[model samples]
Target chain A: MNIILVGLNHKTAPVEIREKFSFPEASIGTFLTQLVTSPLISEGLILSTCNRVEIYAITENAPECFDYLSRFIYENQKYHDNISFDQLTRHLYFYSSTDAVSHIFRVSSSLDSMVVGETQISGQIKEAFDYAMINKATGVILNKLFKKAISVAKRIRSQTKISENSVSVSYAAVGLAKKIFGDLTGKTVLLVGAGEMAELAARNLVNNGVKNVLVTNRNYQRAVELAREFNGISVKFDEIGVELAEADIVICSTGAPYYVINSDMVENAVGRRKNRPIFLVDISVPRNIDPKINTLGNVFLYDIDDLQAVVEANLKERQKEAEKAELIIAEEVETMDRWLKSLNVVPTIIAIREKVEAIRKSEVDKTISKWQRELSEEEVGAIENLSQNIINKILHFPLSALKAEAHLSGGSEVIETTRKLFDLAEEKQPSQDPEAPPAGTAESPEEPISRSRDSRENQ
Target chain B: MEILLYKLPLLFYFAGTVVYLLFFSIKKDSLSNIALGVTGIGFLFHTFILILRTVESGHLPLSNLSGALSFFSWGMILTYLVLEYWYRIHILGSFILPLAFLSLLSAAAFPNEIRSLQPDLNSSWFGIHTTLTVLGAVAFTIAFVAGMMYLIQEKLLKSKRFNRLYYKLPSLDLLDHLNQWSISVGFPLLTLGILAGALWAGDVWGAYWVWDPQRIFTSVTWLFYLGMIHGRLTVGWRGRKAAYLAIIGFMGVVFTFFIVNLLVEGPHRFI
Candidate 1:
């Protein structure tokens, strides 16, 4: 059997095309059932997200399965859009065997994501796999493949910093605040003006457990509206200095061309606050906070460009880590390939023959050694010939029948029966049962995935 | 010879320090754990050497400059291990492991001969004085490390120059907390160690008060940290000011440990 993936992602297809082909979660079970109905496909899974729609399958004939799935999805999309089959097929990308396995692993690891380090794709992949599992659309091969994909994704996450850095400018501001304050709890965030970027950052801070949010704007009504939205009090513009002293974080984005928060003002605030550290982010285009305020002890100031620079640097760091993640995925794909290769009839047949040959040799030697009188050379040779002939005669019909059955699609069931009949499981395969679900990925799947997704969304 | 046993830990410390510095630059989590494991092994070997020396000499191994420096490093690593276990602050090891290694290296440069203890040094009060004082120095070393991290992180934030260290270093709040904790713990140990040393002087030299350079410098270091504690508690002198004071207090420790011990002759001199 071979693994195959057929899909179109945000990179390969436009959103309109992707959306037309994308399967809704509620109807994916019917699609998966339709997917497994093909004679070539033994197992199937459909991963449908806003960014991409992919169909993964285990099949005996990869080329036939690929063609069948393309037509299947094309037919499914015909009901939704008037797009021609050629137009849809032009955007589709297909991977077969090892490439297919590697593709899914990379997809699950988020290396193939729109945002390369995004964590959403992994959960969506798991949800897709779980849906296929509950619908019984997946069998042993796809089960092992998806579980390994999940485990590989987990491994990559633990081993690399791909998902550790924030990519968005507003989230980067939150990340910087964390590096300064360690924890945002009980820290007060003061917004100098009710700008979009400043409001987004304040929302992030509040989500991260920043207890108090104070908004002060040149327009007092706007300040009160923004403060009410944050469940915080609005400070008068004249009290900005006093509020700055109380706030551990200050986000400034007023439209004033000159420095609204000057060095002297920050110095006085620092003195009043008794040298407690404060983080200031100025997301204004023309700059609001004094650059020299950064020179004062315990004060950190970053303007809009500075925040963008931070986001870019973090993206660059993630790109570097993505290379390491690729190496890890390569290693896991090789392991999975070995496991897949072992499922073939050739290896199991050789293993069974080896087991029987060893047993026959040991038993014949034991019987020969039991003689009280030493046998002649001819007699020993005759005994060896008899034992070999007898075993060959016994194994001939079964081995030939196994080989004959290997050409048919029902070969896996026969192979499994032969292994059990011969007890070939004792011969040290990579895994005893690839069908068994991985313990680490099985337990608490929904809680951790949703919780992590929630946290990332908050950021 | 005991020299081989003493030098073995030096090599391990050098390896540990190199690994920690690599971890600092590479920012790999496994490398930090490996660095900790390497340093832990070095600490164990150093402990064995000290225990062997103590058994061989029938006293604590702080009677000579060589033994005292080695003991100082052991205490520092022990304290660092405790802090790391509690906080998992791997970046601190990058700063601290080099200091610990250099102390052992300098200890190896001195004579390895375990001489018979001087009459004045042959007392339990001498042991208590040395242990407490070395431990206090260890706490100051940690404070010094946290302070350096605080300044580096602050510089990174102020200049808007992002680097791996910027992300790896603990937050200013956490580093400042570490600084506060170390100073708080170090000051009292140092005071008690100084008192014990005075008491030992009274027993040996018939005077509790001496104008020894080591004693005067240690008193000055103690006063600096005491003032820091006072300022932080009373007026909230924290963050950069506390970081600077911690760094300065460690320099005082270095001056007393190296300069006063080498330059001046006093009752406290054991080298």
Candidate 2:
């Protein structure tokens, strides 16, 4: 059983369809336990976000097991229509084995997410895996695969400049404020209007260590609720000019059709503030902070469109920056592929060599035992030395041939043919010594046998 | 004798110029180093010929028109090589190669022979004056190159088209500082050179100043560069303004170099 990610995401399904299949936080433990208990399923994780719900699982008949997975989810969630087989049919993505492993990795790393390079997916993917691990629902393949994917995501982020330099102008405004003052600590922030977007930005500001948060909205209760949640003060929407004089950073996101803060008012406020740098974040529809306010001294006023475009432009450039990261990934992928291909040669070579060495070892031990009664210790040791030299001299050529073909095309077939011809599989250990020399060390270079011995042993 | 003494070196300078341009196009560091070494050796031989002319004539070689031009251009090459080594700026070669070859061509092609050596022009103070003035012109020529490169680099950086050759340029901050320093240093040297020339003129011709075409153009150069240094120091005039001033200063130099001397009948018309 290997990686098989099944289910729907934003690309294929609507919210209604996804909701039916989504994993609620409360049910994930039970969900993953049931998934693992299925004889076909070895390990599984449920990545549930609002946009999509995908199941990363280890199962052999990845395509065949869809009915069981969908039925279980439909019965448990009790959401409308409950994502049936026909609905799940088109939206589901099944990655068998390696493709499945790489898919989960890309998803967890956020490489496959709707928003490329978003930091949220990695955390959510981790939560799902942690839930699975808690229930004893993981195996070697899933564990290594998920862990490697997580690290790959981390590598893509830190090594590439894609995540650097904030894209959002809301972030940029906050960024400039930090650049000027070194830290946002002890700085009072006044967010104008309790619009949903403004509230979100305000929360982000508080998260980033703003000392004070003040909210102002036309609706008093909205401001009060936002302020109370963020441990902040609420102000009347009309008193924004007074609030502006106090705020070191102002975020204005109002849905008003007309301008809120006029240039003349800002100009007067600048005079009262004694020319201190007043950061104005205007996330308004038509515009809240007056465009003329920019002409006022020391007032940096950026509107909603400006911040979004800045973030959008930043994301576009990040896509460009991702070009370099793509190069690094391609290099790593090629390297991993080569190493994976090389692993195929390892088992065959080891098995064939073990056979020849066993035969030589057996001949040495048998000859030693045959003379054990008549010979002195020196006589016995000398015959043992002769047998080893003869075996090594006999096996050298075929050993080199097997190793030479190890990396070539049709190399494995030649190795297999050599194995079958020599009947090396039959030369499995006889009366095994508890400890034997490691493979490379075990081969005797001084003996210089033809690789024919290995070929013959394989046959 | 003229071809051996002048044309031979110009050929070497021209060939060295081509090699250096090739060296940069390919980005072969060793080839560039070799180009510098070849040009340096050519300058050495050029220097030897100047010394030989001095020893034969019992006067500093710049007593005549062609001699002065050769000494002035030589100063440009020698200073460039010295600063290149000091700064390790291989890209500057891409700028200086054209100037070096052209100046050498001017020196080689000038018809200034030992035209009945004006005994009055051969004074010790005149030698000192001419040397300082010529050296000052050479220093400004180097500054002019730096200014042009600064403008190009600033444009490329601002456009955000930072390509391979863009990285090869000195940083904008570095080019700005160097551009200012070169103008600052060159301005004062031009001033002293003009002052020395006046002193020597008075000693020889019983007049401290004569508004000859050459002298007029030289004064114009001094004024333009002085304006630049003042603009940069006081007005914080930078970037395009500084670049324009430097170009103006070099134009005066060119007028003094080829045009004024050839077109107008002046004391320096021996060319």
The candidates' interface RMSDs, in order, read: 0.9, 9.9
Best by lDDT: 1
Each prediction's DockQ?
Answer: 0.69, 0.04
TM-score of chain B of 2: 0.91
User: How would you encode candidate 2's per-residue C-alpha lDDT over A1-459 as one tens digit per residue?
Assistant: 224566567766666667777788997888788877887566777778876677766554443445566565556555555556555555555444334544565665555666666778877777777887888787765676666667777888887655654665546555445533445677788988877777777766777778898988899999999899889999998898787788878887777888888887777776666555576777777776767766544556666655665566557656665666565555554443333335545666677667777887888788778878898999877877887787678777877777676555455456556767877552322322223211112112232212111222221
Q: Which consecutive 10 residues in model 1 chain B have the weakest lDDT in total?
A: B1-10
Error of 2 at A38 (Å): 9.5
TM-score of 2: 0.52
Q: Lowest lDDT 10-mer window, candidate 2 chain A? A: A436-445
lDDT of 1 at A435: 39
